[model samples]
Target chain A: MQKLLDYGPLLLGGAVTTICLAVLSLLLATLLGGWGARAKLLRPRGDPLNKGLIRLQARVATAYTTLARGIPDLVLMLILYFGGQRALNWVTELAGLDTLEFSKFLAGTLAIGLLYGAYLTETFRGAWLAVAKGQGEAAEALGLRGLRAFRLVLFPQFVRHALPGYGNVWQVLVKSTAVVSVIGLEDLVGLANDVGKSQRDPFLFMLVVIVVYLGITSVSGWGFNRLERYYSRGMR
Target chain B: MRFDLVFEHWDLFARGVVTTLELVALSLAVGFCIALPCGLALARGHRSARLIRAYVYVFRGTPLLVQTYLFYYGLGVTLGQYDWVRDSLFWPFLRDAWWIALLVFSLNSGAYATEIIRGAVITIPRGELEAARALGLSDRQVDFLVLIPSALRRALPQYGNEVVFMLHGSVVAGVITIQDIFGVTQTFRARYYVAYEGFLTAAALYMAITFVIVLIFRQLEKRYLAHLGLSR
Candidate 1:
């Protein structure tokens, strides 16, 4: 108990780091997911020559999602964290440049973002599909085009459809930040483990850590619910 | 890049594969046993439903890695320190990391399984229960002879996803010094300083296992769910 207080500030700092990592990775994931979703939803009607290129783009997106979803996140993280550094140095050496450091935080973010991007790709695609085909046609008929059409008409409906799944993905992504600790990142779990070891009472410290996680999850769950209600205001 | 290193460690990889399969299979089997009654209670609105929901929420809300560490380092080590626990007959099993890993994995999987089962049970058509009751079957008979079996079948597809997730989750067992497939990759990488080969091979193996699980579940669905098929 006394030990917990003594280490309180460190634990709080770790929690802040964990939250930052989750937010950054989520931003990356949403971007990749949007790009992948667009590539996947492409229709090859532009020209005879471009049709094959569009088909290839869709194929590559499919492969990325499938491979990402198939492997475990921890293994993927380790591969990227360790192998990425080696690959980076090899490239630098060939170009007569100094070896660059690949921070664990960056690798952790990239691996998690890439992994969840696959799931989000499906979620975003489904939401886009559910927006009613006629909605797009109506927008075009009213002289709204491309980004204007999506912003004015499509996105509001997409949020309503996507909120539930987006919430689930966010919850899981937050939990997965714990895995970054395995690679020696001083995140919440890592700091908790260190403190617990020094105090020689891991059980109590772990219980505290568990409560912290529960707090984060429940608070986010409530926030998502509010977002859902806001988006679904006019719906039945 | 290091194909030769992977081939040289083929025996270790094989053993790791067996251990990984055992961890997933045993934990999931035990988890299913734990889930069955809790799922029924929740689906039927039994008085225990509130307690079961709390259990599910706690287990699901936290990360599995934390749970693993809690069980192994936290509970296991804490208990092992007590004089009574050390003197007890159960000490032999408790002292082993394998049993601790199994216990945590089972409980974690059990929580997710309960939800899958409850969803399946509640979705069962009301008329089927009425038909069974109207035929003069006892409540227990209807539950066993109809509700349980049908829920199990209906739950098969979602449950298959759980199995793969469990397989992936079991990689944390490696963290606790269990030589599961992921553990083997870690050992090989540390020993040889080779990047990509061992981990890539393990990834390929995991993908293959996932494919096989998907195939097996598909076949089971076709066979058992034939009556519900579109062709019918």
Candidate 2:
């Protein structure tokens, strides 16, 4: 019991790192996903002559998301961390420059962000499809264009549609932070492991760790549910 | 670049694949056992949703790596306190490396599978339920005769995803010193210092299994879900 108290601060600190990592990855993933989905969605459908550029972009996005589903997340992370470092070193050496040290944080963030981008591409694509077509026509008729139409007409409805899947992906992303510890990131799992090892009481420590994760996911779940409700206001 | 590194260590990789297969098969089998009854309860019986929800939340909320460690080291400490357990026939099995991995993987898959099963059962046709009851079938008989069979078929596609997921999740067995395929890949990487090739070998091996499982599930879906006319 006393040992739990002793380890609390360190675990909390680690939790902070995990949260920050997840948030950064989440932002990168959402942005990339948005772009990827747009590229896939904006293709010159039913037009053979005008299809060159968008077709290539759509092909690349499709390939990325498809391969991601085929491969495990861990494999992708390992490849990026290990292979990327070597590639970076080779480039630096060719430039006659000092070797660049790869930060675990950056590696982890990029790996997870890239992986989730594939996942969220699918999610955003589905949500985009779910938005009623009439709404877009209505927005255009009202002279709403670019970001304003998206914000006023499409965004709220698509956000509502995306909420359930986003909540799912968020939970998955939170759990995935635990794996970043494998690459030597000082996250919550890493801290829990060190404390558990030193105290010689892994059971209690693991139970606490489980509780920590459960708390994060549950609280986030509640928050997403609230957001969903807010977006769904006045709709049946 | 060193294809020979993987080739020279083919035996190690083979053993890793075997161990990985063993883990995947055993865990899915065991998890199916747990998921079946629990899913039925979640679907039909007056079970406490809170209890079932808590179990799924805890397992699904946390990473499999932490869960593995909790079983491998944490549960071992608690089990060490029991002399009778040590004296029993189950002791040697408990001491085996595969035991804890098996246990944790089963529980992990069980939680996910239970959700799949529950979802399938919940979405079973109300007309079917009425037909079963109107034919004077008991609630238990309705589940056994009509509900579960259809749910199993419906659950197949999601369960295929779970199988691939469990295959990937079992890579953490290396953390517990089980020397599974991922473990062998790590060992190969350490020895050769071939970062990309080492992880790629593991990835290819995993993808092959995933590909095969997906094919089998596709066939199963064709046979079972032909009525739906939605081919994924």
Predicted model with the maximum TM-score: 1
Instruction: State TM-scores per candidate.
Output: 0.95, 0.94
Q: For residues B1-232, what per-residue lDDT tens digits would candidate 2 score against the true structure?
A: 8888888889999999999999899999999998988787787654566687778878888889889888887656668668987887877877776898999999999999989999999988899889999999998898789888989988888898889889878888877778898888888888888887878888888888888888999999989888767556
TM-scores of the candidates, chain A only: 0.95, 0.92
Q: Return the lDDT, model 2, position B60.
A: 89
Question: Can you write out model 2's per-residue Cα lDDT over A22-56, one digit (the tens) per residue?
Answer: 99999888998898899889948666756877788
Residue A59 lDDT, candidate 2, scale 0-100 = 93
Residue-pair clashes per candidate: 0, 0
lDDT of 1 by residue, B1-232 (tens): 8799899889999999999999999999999999999999999999999999999999989999999989888657899889998899988777888998999999999999999999999999999999999999999999999999989988888898899889888889988899999999889889999878998998888888888887898888888778767211
On a 0 to 1 DockQ scale, where is model 2?
0.68
* Candidate 2 segments exceeding 4 Å error: A45-50, B81-85, B135-138
lDDT of 2 at B87: 86
Q: What is the TM-score of chain B in candidate 2?
A: 0.91
- How is the predicted docking of candidate 2 categorized under the CAPRI scheme? medium
Sum up the clashes in candidate 2. Answer: 0
Off by over 4 Å in 1: A140-143, B225-232
